[model samples]
Target: MSTVEPAAPDATTPAPAPAAAPSAVEVRETQREASRRDEIAPWLVALEALRRKGEPEWLAAQRDDATARFARLGFPTTRDEAWRQTSVAALARTRFDNATRGALDDALESMPAFRFGGAFAGREAVFVNGRFMPELSSLGKLARVRVRPLRQVLADDPDALCGLIGAAADDDKHPFLALNLAAFQDGAVVEVPERYTVHGPIHLLFISTGGAASHPRVLIGLNRNSQATVVESYVSPRGAHSFCNAATEVLLGDGAVLDHVRLQAESEKAYHVATTATRVSRSATYRSHALTLGAALSRHDLGVRLEGEGADVELHGLFVSDDAQLHDTHSKLDHVAPHGTSREVYKGVLGGRARGVKNGLIVVRPGAQKTDAQQQSRNLLLSREALVHATPQLLIHADDVKCKHGATTGQIEDAPLFYLRSRGLDEEAARALLVWAFAADVVSKLKVAPVRESVERFLRERLPAAGAVPGTRA
Candidate 1:
């Protein structure tokens, strides 16, 4: 081979400029193309179908933007920093069809018992397969409170819906949220005007049918000095294989107070991913209780932003996993203003080959002086193969702030078990007693009596020899 001599450069000629970097949009399109190769075409088809159904121009634009965002971010893999502890490869590989209509008649007739009636009474809004079913919903007589289907609200006032849809939770960071915004058909909308206090809790019930995927969206807003209590329950028929991607956004005005509870008890073969974002204004109080008891793989992302002075937030969560199930709860509380207070307690019980994860973070931004924040995560493993990962972190960039975080992962202490056994309790009974006692610390924080009772019932049904516990309320 003959070597070619290099051409000499001219003194008056300038070197060619380096190629410009790809624009953000172009880079995003490249990512979207790569993600589409991972079997995300079904979702793309679903979004197109929604657009072809004559949706409002504004809504369609929003959906298009969200779809683009989702395509860019794609599904999170184990390689992602935020998802390093969790893997959703199975969910990404599976081809899921969107739930377009309500549940079939036979499916509705064979529904399971309603365990949350006591908590919501007659003020309940029911959704089947992600579509609102007015016949099954009973929004009886709540003064100064509006509870309606989200689709109806959107149809009536697109502007109002647009204002609340992406108010909390940035879709740019969470791909599932972008998917939800792109494909959600119907959900619940609850609004409380200024100085109004709802008499009873407004309940939102989401029931999934087998096979298809459901995207549920919930938005709750409280005007100045308003108060309300809301409960959102997700369930599916036994043995159903479904996918549920849900998101809820809450906005609390000045001096407003809200008590929110979210319960996820899906089928064993189901996939459940949810995000809840709350913004608390001056002197507002926001309390949340999250319970995760079912699903083959589940993840809950809870975020609270204390944006105004004197805002208070309390978050309580309990998760029980068994038989190879994975349940994860990630919480972030940001104290951005002075005098903001936040408290978080999360507990997990893992049995069989199950795995549990709890990640709680408390952040005190600069100028957030006198911010009192505390977070605790406690986990118990009942089987040798069971595993739990607990991470409690405090990031403080401000001085004169009181912030503490603690995490513990271990098996039940021998001393407590021995004490219970000495009191004539069997091994199973003692274990159940200890587990319930651990979970009760979070459940008892629920101020609502009926809600607490329902959680107790759920735990009793799942725990071994739970009925043998001494007291009625664990």
Candidate 2:
């Protein structure tokens, strides 16, 4: 049996001095050894088990490569450039067992009202603890489109999923991506054929029951000239402290169009990290809306690559953090071909002692002329104790590109509160209205009516109560 290594000590703690002076060479070697000893081994054991279960040789090789990468990178710290603002040491210290094989009995009847009765009423796929439960799903037949559990696809024809799974995501830089590649058991797979258009959006629901770790992977592909919309929802029972690591990859063929909506509302005690990678081909379009509202420590990474001429991409995100929660979002858009266009707008609201971070980047590669890109990040602090950090960047290699970026972080304006109060609104109602208006910029971009309304309702229920902030008195 292989033994797992323990988590490293907190970075904030000072290291003890050596009894005897040591050479610099010896100290470097000792640091390397310590790093190796901190690698998580149980996750490797689970990966090996999956490989030994008769998975394809290619997949086994991929898992092995990812395992090595993850071992080298280990868990990130606040010292790391990408993680300089957020600390994940607490998550690393927690030892989480792999999820067990079981479905929640109340999964069907307990589906959240926000998820059901929508335009996507009977077209939802449900997964509990990273395992697909067909009994709770209602995915009917659609022309020129195929939706199936990823495990089923792997079991039937593993080769069919090749070149699409890890094509857009880079595990070398992100250890979480490596972890997902090494241990993800099952998720959703969607394929739309050439020139086909799905009338309704496809909904994927993932729920966790706490006390374990779940890795969920979603793969979506749209052939040339096809169009589809996908909705992904992540939630958990209140007070659950589970750990969730998820990755999603989307491929758009020439002239294809795809709209994606992601909703994350996990337990207040849960740890959640997710990455979304999208690649757009010639004349293709890809748009995404991300909403985050729950989790003790949550991070979402969005990466988009415009690899073909005339491709377009847009990203919109909103996050609300309360209590002592922490939420972070990092996004990157790469324009590699001529005539490529990209835009991003993210808004965040922080209350109580909560904190939020937003980092957005736009890159136009060399020889990519006629590239148009813009990024904006806006934040609101509902309380004096709340904090936020916003960063927006633009990297243009071509002189003929049009690129712009901006960021703003502050509290609600007293003018808006006074105006609302003058309109016969209570103090609490007025405050809530202003907060919603700040978030409406992102929520209004949602094309799905039910999704937009549900998100609005959720924000209304979670926003800080009236007069929660000390200086809000007009």
Candidate 3:
């Protein structure tokens, strides 16, 4: 028997130390950035695969800044204040290798919600994955607003998008925001010129197929005295593992009025994150109605800055979580000018061991006198294991401001349940009626009739936890 001996070390060279194993955080970070080579490029991350020729230097610089920011900050964990109640460990551990191409006709053939009708029929801008498919979208000219592809606008006249793209999403604290800004390939850009009004709501529908991640963004700019309504919806296949990181920037010029509705109804197995940054000018109004009811783990961060005097903001949200799902929301209203007004009401219903979290604040700057701000958080639990953590705060640095907040969490009143039961209604029916009574008001707040109808149908079909229709949208 012969054994090969190791070569003797040279006396002139120093011995190398044994390599150390990576820390848990380091391993997780590396896995989050895992990439695979493909036809597009050697670097195959959905984030790094994006490239454009002859793009504006400002746009390129913005993307570079976002990329560097995400690399430095990485993903937030449970230790972070804003992310304490929610966890992204599963998302970080998974390796997403594609951006999900735009060829998704077969995947969307069965989803009727993607099919727009009535007022939303001709005003739809559909995005598969993160790319815009002109074949699936309707971009006819409106009376006041022009719905154009953001990428096309950048290619044609980059100057039109200089300040509208990243003007409000410059937050380094939001890793998902940075990721979306850095990687977004195509999105809708709705532009309303001065003194014009858009009679109908412009629907921006983003659909994600399975096995990949997508970064879809929206840029809406309403000039002086303009009015427009925008509805943004995110949906995916049922129980499909995917990631949808979306961002929307809304700039309301002076005297502008904008009505925005956001609907998140993703797959039960998906991970969803969204950030909306809006700025309101003098006498401008920004009203938001957000409904969150999907994804295994979902989170939404909304920030509205009242930059001009007499600016107003109204926020209304309804989140439903069941079957071990987790839904989280963090919202901030910054009153930077006097006479600014803000009103917020967020509600959640948790069942089947689901969990809900909300952290919201209304901050008044020193000079923001007469800042009338009010916030409320209401939650209802259907089972003993269902839980919700709500924090509605008011931070006032101004003296003459009226800022107040309230939060309430509890189960349905037994008196009402008994009353309904005495009326010959079954237990599940009674509970469903009560839950609908609690959730319907918020759904009505949405101005889009088609979206409102869809939400109402989902509520009727899936509510009353014990009677939840299997295979139906949760």
- On residues 68-130, what C-alpha lDDT tens digit does candidate 2 reach at each position? 988778788776667888998788778776545542643343466536574575678888878
Q: Model 1 — TM-score against the truth?
A: 0.90
TM-scores of all models?
0.90, 0.90, 0.87
Best by lDDT: 1
Better of 1 and 3 by lDDT: 1
- Residue 172's lDDT within candidate 2 is 72
lDDT of each: 0.84, 0.83, 0.82
> How many clashing residue pairs, candidate 2?
0
lDDT string for model 3 (336-429, tens) is: 8899989999999999999999989787878889999999999999899999999886767779999889999999999998998899888887
> What tens-digit string does per-residue lDDT give for candidate 1 at 1-474?
122111223325234445598666567756866775555666677667766465677778888899998877778876565677789878888877654354455347544354454446568888887888887777776766888898898778767776668888768778899999998888989999999888777889888777778889999999999998898988887787889999999999999999998889888999999999999999999999998988999999999999889999999999999999999898999888899999998989899999888988788888889999999898988899998888777778789998888998889999999999999999899988898888988888877676677778877877889776545632
Give the CA lDDT, 0 to 100, for residue 309 in model 3.
Answer: 97
For candidate 3, the per-residue lDDT at 472 reads 36
Candidate 3 off by > 4 Å: 1-46, 99-103, 465-474
Stretches of model 1 off by over 4 angstroms after superposition: 1-36, 52-54, 99-103, 110-112, 115-119, 470-474
| Model 1 clashes, total count | 0
Worst 10 residues of 1 by lDDT: 1-10
